[model samples]
Target: MMSDCGLDYIELLQQEVDRTSAKLLYLRNEEEPEEAPPPRHTPHTCSAPRRLAISPGLGGKPLTPPFTENLRRLLFGRTVRVFNFDWRKSFFHFREPNSELSYALQVDQGGARAVQMVIQARIIKHLLFSQQGGSEGRSLLSLTELGPPEQQGALAAALSDSLWLAGQEESATVTMVTEDDSPKPPSEYRLDLLTEKMHTFVFNRKEELSSFLLDHIHCFQEEGGHGVVLFLYSLVCSRTIDRIREDLDSSTAHLLQRRLGNFVCSQALLNLLLTGRATPHVCNGTQAPGGGAAPLDPPLQGVLSRGDIGYLHWSREQMDRDRLLQVGSMLKTPRFPVWLCCINSTYSVLFSLTRSLLSDWRTEHQFQLFYYNGQNSQNSTARLTIDTHSHHWEAPSVDPGVDLEKRFPSLEMTIRTKWEGASINWGGIPPFY
Candidate 1:
């Protein structure tokens, strides 16, 4: 009986394995073959050979010294600002190579203010080989496609390597303002220290640091205060992910995802600065987003809806501010509250100003606002109060009458004539007295 029972158990185990294998085979057969990717199109076919030469304005005379120094600093510097530009139609147009390229670099030399440097260069080599891809051509080096982990790793490796290279470059006799009293560390040491601090900062405070960095990014731009505000506004003005997802359109969702991903990555870089390991600086060529390269997924693809996006923005803003306050309070620094309040006031003023401008535009165009309580006759008697004061006035016909001021008004004229035809059932309502 014991031998028979053991044999039966072995048989059952064999049967289960066979069943699973058959199911796996059936699923594999049912799967459709992946379609072959379309052939990659070459945008520019011109094979003209261009000499390797730095632009005149990149650094006054002798391209070798300043060019190498600045490039090294950009790649390995402790505090670096990651810029994202639209580059729709400018000399630095990523789509097409022009005669010249222009960019502005700013470095905070451990002083009260930042040092501004402008560099205009010509593109000599559009492509380079990377360890991951042999002879693979790329328009720009993008951290977004790399994903967060790989991007951070690559940046760390690059900074380490660049610092070593910077040390090898011949030193110049020309002297500028040296802020550090101690002899400047070899380029490699400085780079290592900067990168180490950044890693520490990012590891500690992920999202909060990113948001704070984005808020103060304007101070790093070369276009000065005027363009910085506009630039930042454009960066944050894209439609939310939820709205894009609700549309159920693949292309649009991809576009939004790409943009959102880029914004998130840019913010992540800013978060790296709060570690106080190094002062922040900006690099010229690295200024543009997607910098002539197409996103693997466009901004609109796989994006969240408008409501969700708004919530995310609000949540991030609140959390970041709260974290800053907590950290500042712990440090017992008086400057923290003042700085936080100032930034809050600036954002509030900007939002109000923009809203007013948009409202004026809507008024000129005869646009209107429509509201609804989303209640039926069964719930009509329920006391409801709508706040119109917070909303912008668009259509003159829709007025907030004195009756609405009462605690329990007989009628609430919240819906406009436009919405009445679509969202409301006017036939059921009593005729106006």
Candidate 2:
């Protein structure tokens, strides 16, 4: 009954609605798949960003300029392998590009002194002087063979100290080996005279010690020599001072006492022991060939005015170049008993490790002193470690001597074959265990 146009319009509208519904269903089907899984938390199984670091690599910040420059000079162009000690983990971590050239040098935080001294003195000396006189100079020179006996003696002393610091005491040996293939002359290094007990005088009270030395002041003087300095060194090493008194004779001691000066080597040595720095200069009644004492604004005490201390292994230019070394603090006094003593940077001396210098007087009474004769002589190779707490030379039951081979054979061989005069090892392979 409806009109033809009206009925057709209604039908068209219905068709359009049906078509639109079909197109929407097709589009929905194309957009999403039925097999897709739902999203989940699962935080434990997933990876997250790492904590940001202050430095580029896992290793912490870079070494300071002074340390870097030192490494650079010591290793030259060699690749530097860094070994960081993680106190937290109680282990060492190493880093490098290639395992082969990565670590040619090893530097620890606390033990840099040993490496530093060796590089500055031994390696540097060989590099600069080994080629002299057109003969390939031996890298290792005995104390006896070197000239300027005083200078050689000092260097030998430093080497000996380094050995002890490395804990190579009993492992080290003195042999008849020479730089050249020449006949092994009588072994300069001897160990027979060593005794178990060191004749050391321990004074808990400084004033008492001062009084005693002052009373026997004449026993320290020498003709044209710094006998007081030597005496103090001997005392620190726990050498038999009574024997020295005997050797000098009573008449000489009396004459020396009468001729003693207000400022003597003893005072300088005492200052070194007390303050860890020698203030007075030792005067031998002789003027320098060229000039007077270096004009220090603050002024220093003692006899010799010029800087009497010089490292034969270190040139003035080299010393000035290294800023960290320029300051005398590097050689500052360590805690008591553990002394980093130097004889004008010419010789090295060390006190006992068995007792700390700061130990309570009530608990422990003595310490040990170690002395290495680095002079270029048959006896230059000998090392004397004395138990300073005991005043007696011969303790009947005590074992005074420590056999390096028996105690630390591996360490001794390593030192002899590897580290004796070799350059610093960056690989951290030098048995610091």
Candidate 3:
């Protein structure tokens, strides 16, 4: 037994050493490859030949950054402990309520604003769960739940009143009242009674509650941006549901229902903002152009005005072409268009997503109001053709004799990258419920 244990320990140590060595090599730039020039191809008269050069260094390579180290540190570092709650349930529960809030905001806004409007709503509620140490199965703890549509008219009234009262001292008062109102407070309010109860529960400890709430609020604000706030809320709710089930054997179907509701509400709000109508509130709302309300949403309408719908339309086209190319590449078939389209779409999507997410209000206004309508006098076009005559290649037989484990070693690598990116993106946002 002793010898076996010793062997296991040695193996573990060796593994750690290998991992560290690999990471150090990467950090020191020893694992990166040099760049190469593009292959010669038939070029269109209006465009330069497309280059197929590899990037020069580690950072130059797209989607190949060293994320493991960052992830490891984030996971192991000291983290703020927010109470685990079922996300899906919270989402579904809040969906209708938030949708109502959105409807109210629209009615209150009254279709007169020159600029786009945004209304943020938050609510808190109590939750109950099992506590193994205190009871046979569980117990109840007073916690806070943040969501929208605390009541029917409260959110809309607050948002509308705030908008109308902007640029005045009353705006701050309105904001505070909206943020601090107890959505479902008990009928009776006795400050002295609550104070005495709080004193009695001193032994239970409560300092962490304030800190956790602060942390959550800070994280939420920091993650605020176009679509980020909604996305973060969704992520938190999903993760909470997952954590609860895995850790507590809790049934999360109810939670999932709630999460769906929240998602619907968010979608409805987004739709309302985009389109000038409340069609998104309908259960069978149409999303396609011309089928639903004219012009769809504001952002999309803005895109159309600029004639840059080509950006997104081109992206979708490229994605389809890339999918076909990947299959062709695997089958060793002719894949010139597929490969080119895949690379081009990948670059374009990267640029567009980044720009859309990071561009500020000023930049967006400038683009939409001025540059979008202007004509590009110096229009240019380019094309390229792959010359595979000199390249020797043979298609492998369709027999299932290939060693997939060795041939597709990078499959796991690709999956890990995608998962890591998603996690990082979601991590910055606030929890839904």
Q: Which of the numbered candidates is closest to the native, going by highest lDDT?
A: 2
Residue-level lDDT of model 3, residues 73-177, one tens digit each, is 122121111101111011111122323122111211111111112222111100111112321222111111214423322333322222222212121111110
Q: Model 1, residue 82: displacement in angstroms?
A: 9.3
Badly placed stretches (over 4 Å) of model 3 are 1-278, 281-433
Scored by lDDT, model 1 comes in at 0.21
User: What would the TM-score be for candidate 3 when compared with the true structure?
Assistant: 0.17
Candidate 1 Cα misplacement greater than 4 A, ranges: 1-84, 87-337, 340-433
**Candidate 3 — worst ten consecutive residues by lDDT sum?**
193-202
Ranking by TM-score: 2, 3, 1
lDDT of 3 at 143: 14
Give the C-alpha miss distance for residue 196 in model 1, angstroms: 29
Models 1 onward score TM values of 0.17, 0.18, 0.17
Q: Across residues 189-278, which tens digit of lDDT does each residue of candidate 1 receive?
A: 211111111101111232332332333232222121212212211111111123212322322212111232121211211211111111
Evaluated at residue 308, the lDDT of candidate 2 is: 12
C-alpha RMSD for every candidate: 26.8, 34.1, 28.7
Q: What Cα-based lDDT does every candidate model obtain?
A: 0.21, 0.25, 0.20
